[model samples]
Target: MTNRYRSVFDIIGPIMIGPSSSHTAGAVAIGHVANRLFHAPIKEVVVRYFESFAQTHRGHGTDYAIISGVLGFDPADRRVPLAVDLARRQGLKITFIEDQGLSPIGHPNTAAVTLINAEKEITVWGCSVGGGTIEIRKVDLNGLIFTPQGPLPILFVEANQPIGAALDQLFGENYRRPRVTHQLADHYIYQLDLLDRPFPEQIDQARGMSQDLTLL
Candidate 1:
């Protein structure tokens, strides 16, 4: 799979984290990207885990990793403990879904984050590629934009529902469902390729994290 998409290296460069870098730090990175995609100040986040993330997330601190990421913290930061409690205080609702069937096309370590601010709802799907890199697949906030369909670091215009609806109309059914795999390469690179790279910047800061956690 790696052979097929040699471009992945150009995507997510490096990262550092715990034993299961892909499942832990990488997953955390995915959550972090989702956090950014929400754009709005998140009042709540319902996190759904798939495959190994659901089964052993607790032991692996996958939940903590995700919550920290959603709170906009780095995966390698030791403040994750405090971040979890802080997120709760900030009114974030986190959940875990162990649905193997629902996660059809994603890396083994995948998650669906439903973010809400007031009555507006945003759903984001992401995958944690190894080494603390992420790929954001979907983002829909009550029809609001900021989707990967555009370009990475895609300009956040603070659009309204009506504009989002118009964008939706323009997309016309193509904006549904999140896909993160290259048929030839069978691997996910978080939001690297998913997000449009209008000004491609590859900063792999997660390099040493995986080694520290012995996730080699």
Candidate 2:
């Protein structure tokens, strides 16, 4: 799935430092999401490229695009080109592999990434759909389809209790209610897009839901 472009901002392509949208901007978005999922300093990572990505990644700035994004640098950041050095200075280890787009990926411009932090490993798969748009196909092996777009805050909650009720209790019913969906059995996914609103630091009272929750 691609991000909905409601304005002409996307029509002219994003304002970023990149040579190609599919290879650079999209790749940066993919890595940005992966970093959020990882949720900690990335100690090590394995990035496998496929099809067009494998063939032309180095030539099109895909390598730096991803590295800079994970390091929390925006695409327009002038420091994007120095991402690899920055990661190395932070003791991050990265390995790039060329593959035939394995895993459950259906998109051609794909990169299956395994991001390792001190506590856990996050597996994320992303695909570039061209024109600076990309799709986050899956995370942690559970099939998901969403795009991280807009300035609004987005949160994904995986919980054992009724998160809808928790959200209502936390933010109030009159507030922008979260959209709920089912992930694995005994688990629920909550997506809240409150324009410019900030979430609290704690959301307890639901079994480890806040622990696995992701804020993007």
Against the correct fold, how does model 1 do in TM-score? 0.61
For 71-119, candidate 1 gives per-residue lDDT tens digits of 7777667776466678877777766677765454355767877877776
Give me candidate 2's TM-score against the actual structure: 0.71
Q: Residues 120-179, candidate 2, lDDT per residue (tens digit)?
A: 777667887777766665666234454333223356676666667666566553234435
**169 in model 2: Cα distance from truth in Å?**
12
Instruction: Tell me the spans in candidate 1 whose CA falls farther than 4 Å from its real position.
Output: 1-17, 100-102, 144-216
* Most lDDT-accurate candidate: 2
Query: What is the clash count of model 1?
Result: 16
Q: What is candidate 1's CA lDDT for residue 42?
A: 80
| Candidate 2 wrong stretches, greater than 4 Å | 1-4, 101-103, 141-155, 164-215
Worst 10 residues of 1 by lDDT: 207-216
